[model samples]
Target: MNVRQIDPKQRGFLIVNSHPAGSAETVRRMWEQIPCRTDGSGPVVLLLGHSAGYGLATLLTGLRRHGIRGVGVAFEGAETERRTATAGWYRTAAADSLAQGAGHDFVFVNTDAFSKAGKHEVLALVEERFGKVDHLIYSLAAPRRTDPETGTVYHSVIKPLGEPYEAPALDFSGDVPKVGRVYLEPADDEERHATEQVMGGADWRLWVEALAGRGLLADGFTTVALTYIGSDLTAPIYRQGTIGGAKENLEQTAADLAAVLGDGGRAYTAVAGAAVTQASSAIPSIALYTAFLRTVLGDGFRTTVEQAGELWDQLTGAVPLVLDEQGRIRLDGWELDGQVQDRVRELWADPEAGLERARAGADWFMEQIRELYGWGVDGVDYGRPVETTVPWPTPGVSHA
Candidate 1:
């Protein structure tokens, strides 16, 4: 083990190091926040891309609230002698430790979830140990994906499809962060197709098919892909962009997956609200939008953990599973509320001025960014020497 005092180095939206102590504490806080635990029994879940964002939230919510035991597949860098592990890597380790202490079965696979070998490895594990996967959560997000069968690499772009988009964007790449206007060129047919191939539902569908073909999926199997549909303010660069084209394909894929699941099974896209996630932070105007959102939503803003818990309740019949007119699960209702949008519009009209009024929100947004990388959590000893090469608890099928 290598021990050193590590401090985060930020370049743009990226944080180079993660604090293990703080990461563990963040996991603990989320775990402890659950109002109550169930009978210590629930579904055997299989989560893909479950190391951060909505994926991580779903994993924790399942483990703590419903007593789920399962496998997670994600692409993460293990801690090395020269550098610290990624935030998700540390977060997974913390989750494994906690789950073990609580007597729950959880395993992590550190490999490329987008590859064929990765899929086969997970299938073999399920066949050998976990006989049935009751719930499959597809939370994978990536900028590029290579088709295992064809060797064709597709890269996703965030440009609008038909017309150019111009918006005020937030920047965290410098000592003094500021908001500035950004212009994006439109995507051509090929680029649109590539983006859809990378971020869309094809891979999601492939995973489900593979599991079902091997008889690994349980009866009445449930699957959901986490997604986002920002308000009209971000429609040009988001909901109406190339990414939107991908999301539309994803939603359609969900329907197709449901058909494959047959009568008893279910599959849908769970549209979640905007928050400060690594993926969202990389988007052009999201940082600005979320800062204002946090300000306007105030106490109403729901964290990914909270949203995951609600989704779990609906999935387990603990509460009503609400669906919108499109037959997709709607978790972004609060973010899209008429009153909420009205207030957000007041701020969106002029972000520079809006940010001044929403300073609290802006500050909260910045803190969330720090917290994601395990740097800004409360009660963590930054001065203490911490282990950077902490081993993953269970070695899954793939070698990290």
Candidate 2:
């Protein structure tokens, strides 16, 4: 099927495409791209959350750079009220781009991961289609979820402690930049747990167990979960904060998954460097930090695509995995470089001075942010309107 010919308005089917010949060719090309390690054979890789940011980039790198043609499972809700049209559109576009670029088949599943039955369905599909999966990448970031245990749905909110905390907001309403203080309210306990359920390791563990139960995990298969360890300055709002706890749980879950994989399989937590993704933009203090980090680091920060390429290189036996003092894979080494962190510390010590420097450096930082959204990605035709169907997997939708 011609992926580019897909309809843009269709949103209820989990986009599934069959490319037997193309997928076989992709496998052959991957053999040529990946360097042989005397130790073992290459296995098929499956990627979750394969439509955005790191997940999408990883899918691209694994295919275009490593020659690994694998399946991508992206879940989209059936009802318009349950899903955002904007997100569905972007994901479909990304999936189309990936399938077209790599010449591999992609299966989109439209189901909520918060339920046990939904999880089982995805596992079944993977087993029936791929048979075995060599590598798994989990990268889901959502704001709210319904607690299966309590039967209560929680919605997340971005608020501050005590009376609404107000901060200077940038006005993009005019040609010239104007600033105003924006008020934020604090989030409640239920809201916090809902965020955790949606973003945390519960679904990750489910995916691992489901795959293993189906006997789809190849021996020595590797699974990775992306995480972060921000500085103490943002701890109250980030690391130690609500989302912070979830990230910690995710790391711990990775360790548990490793044990489950036994001696042959391994699990890694890649402490990825900060990059502007659609999800990251929603965080309160992250934009300011990212703006500052970009200003200070200039071209040092790696793009999501670059990071994914590096990750694929390491996973494919091209580069030796580097671990930090904490024993976690150091994918975000640039973020923790002593020199860089020291400068960040200096800026944190004096907010006024830091803001001055960041504002002065805004141009370079803005450019980097724009490039991250595929604005300046070389060889991409941004002017042309690309179309793809939203692969919303309804039970009645035919697989073929």
Candidate 3:
């Protein structure tokens, strides 16, 4: 099967295909960004859904900065003869290559993290390979989840909670980009519950319990589930919506998990900053907000990898962990700055001017979206053909 260059195009909030070389280069560059190296003697970490985005960021930080040998679980599609693989697939492949080159012990388990079988497989691997897990980071991002026990499917929604919400949304799927108002109806009870089921802490709890039951949790074990609580500007569609309800559930779950762990063990909900991620790029409300946010922050804007490095420093005691009233790690201080919010509000109040201001950084934002799918990356010629069937170097055992 011949695999050629994929011209990633925006369709609504999703990008179409991926480029292998671009993804490898992206990972290589991210690896170079962390100049400080470790002796591969750090904690053994387990990261869920760590193919791309924040999960990937944390995984790289632990491996590069802390010299942690670890395993990552993610669900990514492989490329076929007619179509390219998912961007995350290529990214994982690239990460594996980098790890091997650096003589780091890293593995990628490509499977459904929500499945009981998948959990069992990973647990067994950990027992055989790492003996115990020092830290578990839950950063899974999926549209839906299937209960391992009952096989019930739950789908997450992004609608508001009680009332219909309308906000400025950005559209870059067409030739001419535009910013316009988008109206969304509130989520029904079923949808909200389903969203919580999919995005909440239930699965996180299960994983922790399963690990503990198997005697796989290390002494002083700790866990953190990544979350976001954006500013009021995105409250209607984000923090005050179904997603917010799910996050609340996640945080509560963290508390419960911490209680069960007892004796020096801890659990936390890490509040992360918003950025141009594959998931957020699909949400028009978030897209519009981030565009303006990038405009306002300018050189101050921190990428996901940068934030992950900070989080690693905080979590590992290299620096103090800043927690808010909720007892969760706060990494979104810059985005929530009062002065920054005031400026974003000024832009939001006037869509025309906001779009104009955001336009100056539109190239950057769009390039981010493209880079998510391994397109629009520098030092790579998109016109050249690339191998699509790049194999995952350290694929883990599959229960099925």
Candidate 4:
């Protein structure tokens, strides 16, 4: 794994192809030079909610080197909601011109995955083009979800369980960033129920059933949904709060759906570690914890891409997939190590010490947020006119 950060236009957020050693272009060259098999032994992975999420990065870093087909779904929001017009524009560029620059078999579905029409579009593409999807990875996080049956929409909230919870938060969203103890109260009954209904496995089941009905799933297929369970500090807001109930629902849904997919198919909900994500930064306590963790732990921070690569290795390892007592894939095991936890707890117990140590941590975390949108990458010359679009390479010019 490359620990040193490369240019964003080269390998980071911007991800423009520079045709360097070990780059996607180099990988393609090796494939052709070695006279390798055109068809690889890898499975076809379909990712939903990829553009601004982790699933895409996870799978891409793991599978892109192999000559496997890839499919993704993401929407560009009008004003930076989930996918923005700019997001669609640039992501489409990366998918075509950079990441899949070698003319690899890749497809990008730019639409709303939550809607029936969008789901149908996904199904139609798979049936017509790919035929069978080997793995289905769902990593979507939307603010609101409309009940498929009742048609009543429910929005998710990120508040504590009982009394108001106070935690030190770094607000870089303001003109000047500052850390302060912000207070947030618990959610009402409606908010709690709605959060569970939406973020839970209800949607996962719906998506799987849809694909299964159409025979789009490959035999011996495995599906996985991402979840999170942090340290005890954020329990009231994350694990024990409304989102926690929703997560419990998600785990249960995964179990039920896995059983339903009994034809050699498996489904699992894996707990992911806290890192800099568009969604995590919105959550009150998680952001603070991540900053503090980074402060104490050095560049021990692993982005979605690194986490996914680690996960892929475990999934395709020599032995069977291991699970915790609760039958859950404990991907966050490293993050919750006893030693790391003890140190973080020690700092949490003393805010004076915490702030003193984590003074630069929150600021560093904020810098990571900039990388998400291609701002903080090196070697990206803004002085030059930006090339915002490109048709995918093919018979036109193979980076291969």
lDDT of 2 by residue, 322-393 (tens): 766655677787777788878877765565567677674544434434443333334445345343223343
Rank list by TM-score: 3, 1, 4, 2
- Candidate 1 on 1-400: residue-level lDDT in tens? 7888888887777888788888878888888877658554678889998889999889888988998877888888877666688888888888887777777777888888889899998878877767889999999988999998899999989898788989987766666557888999999999999999999998998899899889888888899999999899999999999999999999999988888778879999999988788888888898888888888888889888899998999899999989999888989898999999999999999888987887787678878889988988889989889878877767453221
Model 3: lDDT equals 0.85
Q: Which candidate model has the greater lDDT, 2 or 3?
A: 3
Candidate 4's TM-score: 0.82
> Residue 45, candidate 4: how far off, in angstroms?
1.7
* lDDT score of residue 21 within candidate 4: 20
Model 2 root mean square deviation, Cα atoms: 7.5
Instruction: Estimate every model's Cα lDDT from 0 to 1.
Output: 0.86, 0.60, 0.85, 0.66
Q: Per-prediction TM-score, please?
A: 0.96, 0.73, 0.96, 0.82
Task: Choose 1 or 2, whichever is better by lDDT.
Answer: 1
lDDT against true structure, model 4: 0.66
- Pairs that clash in candidate 1: none
* Per-residue alpha-carbon lDDT of candidate 4 for residues 67-170, written as tens digits (9 for 90 to 100): 45656777653322222233433444455454444446667777778778888887887777678888888888888888766778889888767767777665
Residues 141-253, candidate 3: write the lDDT tens digits. 99999988899999998899899998788877677568877898999999999999999999999999999999989988889999999989898788889999999999999
Clash counts per candidate, in order, are 0, 10, 0, 3
Candidate 2, residue 107: lDDT: 56
lDDT, candidate 4, residue 366? Answer: 65
When 3 and 4 are scored with lDDT, the better candidate is 3
